[model samples]
Target: MASNTPAPEAPFDAFGGGAGPAAPDTEWNPTEGSLRAENRSGGRHRVVKQRSNFARSSTVLGVGVIAAVGAGGLATAQEKPPVAISLPDLPDMPDLGLPDAHDLPGVGALLPQENHETVAEGRANPNPLTVATYATDDERATKAERAEPVADVQAGAGDAGEALRARILQQAEQQQASADAADKAAAEKAAAEKAAAEAAAKADAAEKAAAEAKAKAAAEAKAKAEAEAKAKAEAAAEAERLAKLGASYSMPLSSYSLSATYMQSGSMWSSGYHTGLDFAAPTGTPLKAVHGATVKSAGWSGSYGYRIVLELSDGTEVWYCHLSSMTVSAGQTVGTGETIGRVGATGNVTGAHLHLEVHTAGGDGIDPAQWLRSKGLSL
Candidate 1:
């Protein structure tokens, strides 16, 4: 048999039908008996998800804390200027049917130690929630006072963070641009210096070549002048020697008219041409030694009525033919212009004349008149 009377203390079923042991009376425990019946609107109630104020506030503040910590670590590791981090906007906490903790007096002492600063100070808490169930009154008040300035600082930090990041990027770009300019300038300067060096080298080479060419030309000119001077000196010496030698020679005869010349063609001569120079004169005209010489021969010769031969110092021989008489004998030394013979009518001659012949050391005959003229004597 079932009874309609309700139990005075029934444990609340967390699941739909399960019942647990009754809790102690000293602590609060949810139970079906403590719950009140509500009027039905002819529809089942929809279940709604719920969240605590402390958990929501902690999630919002964690993001800001993590961002700040990461920025500080990056600055330390790189040894660079500290960068500002922008924190995300924290969403407003939803109303949870609970009273606002800030409106109640001494409400911070009732909140969990984790949510004490957030609930009492009416702001997000940067510190993580602690496992402690409650916070002291003094700790809440002190933390609440500190939280004001922290909020103020954070309010301005958003704008300051963006400005700082922009400034750092701008400074980096300026440094890079300056470095690029310095590199470009250095390259241009190096190119200019190289070009100047090459030009200088070319100039030096040209100057050296020009100097060498000039030196060669000067040497050639000097050599030519020396050769000209040597030739002039030799000519002057030869002329002086000939002038002294001319004084020693003399003409064969003083007074005579020239007749046949050497190498003259005549039928009377046995040879095809006359071999001697002829001087027409009186039968007894005197003949003289043409130069200083020894008498080589003085006698009658065939075809020639009389003849005399003289040999000079240079091995030259002079012959006087058709002579009437000869004053000098064979092997007699005579001075220049001394009497040696007389003119006469000789063989192959039409009238009285003196015939003269000259022979070189090799016995080759030459023109007597030309030989005499070469000794500075006039015909």
Candidate 2:
């Protein structure tokens, strides 16, 4: 049996070289054979395993890179500053070549034109070019085009110009009306004030005139009362004088007989002078006043114990002396032949008699018998 022949090789199995029991069929089937079988065939399978391991590690590294990039994006989102948007600044505007109201189209033509005149009238007209003007494309248009019928443009321009003019005129008229109303109101107020003042003045004048009339009436009444009082006093005085004249003529003293005359030098006294007239009547002969007169001196004198002097209306002074007693007082009025005193010889006399004397207002003594004769008395 020692023949030089290799032992018969064992039958190879697809799963493993050792055929323990045929491996059970699994549900997973691979397109390649087992790894040990393929390795035994060649190293190509190890190379393929190494390449798959490298590919798996590279996929893990790529996943880690993507995670890191995502985390960095979240951090940057949290750390970013808030955005502040700003607007651009503008420059100041410059002046452009623009005209005032005066230098535009159509306004110069529409305004009233000025004319020359003398300066004495003191009138002036506004500059026509000072009027306002409209801004429009038609202002720059040709004259022929402007004159043409451009639908509603010509009509609108004419209406607008007319409306502006009408508005200005209406405003001016309103202002004028307001001014006129104010002036009228002021004039009416002034007129009312003047009328009131005039009325007050007239009332004052009337009051003054009434006061003057009352004063004049009072003065006239006073004057009339005084005149009546004066006339009554004169009438009473005249009646008293008439009554005295009637009483004086009724007495009988004018018929008395004179026995002796005063101032006779017949040794009747120690002085050798008779000083009175001797009536030579009984003791109670009634004396008489010579005329209508006042008894001015009726008291006693030193030599003639009691005496009486009668003052006539014409101021002739008569004296009745050698009285036993006086029956009249000073200022007592008496009529002619009225009893004044009784006869006595209390003074330097030897017989009872009356010392009759007369003195004029001029202070000159005269004979009493001569004075009685001058008064139309027979005594």
Clashing pairs in 1: none
**Cα lDDT, model 1, residue 364:** 99
Instruction: Compute each candidate's TM-score over C-alphas.
Output: 0.44, 0.32
Error of 1 at 30 (Å): 18
lDDT of 2 by residue, 1-379 (tens): 0122211332122223332222244222223567567677775332111123233223333433432332232333223332211111111111122221122232222211221122112323345422322223324545454344322233444455566678889999999999999999999999999999999999999999999999999999998888888888877876666555554533324334577786778865566766455565544466888777898889878776678888887888887777877789999988766788887776765667666777888867777776655454545
Q: What are the Cα lDDT values of the candidates? A: 0.64, 0.54
**How big is the positional error of residue 185 in model 2, measured in Å on the Cα after superposition?**
99
Lowest-sum lDDT 10-residue window in model 1: 82-91
User: Tens digit of lDDT per residue, candidate 1, span 101-156?
Assistant: 32223222224344434433555443433211223333544555544433433433
Candidate 1 ranges with C-alpha deviation above 4 Å:
1-233, 254-286, 302-305, 322-325, 342-345, 349-355, 366-379
Q: Pick the candidate with the highest TM-score.
A: 1
lDDT of 2 at 82: 23
Instruction: Give me the displacement of residue 357 in model 2, in angstroms.
Output: 1.3
lDDT of 1 at 181: 99
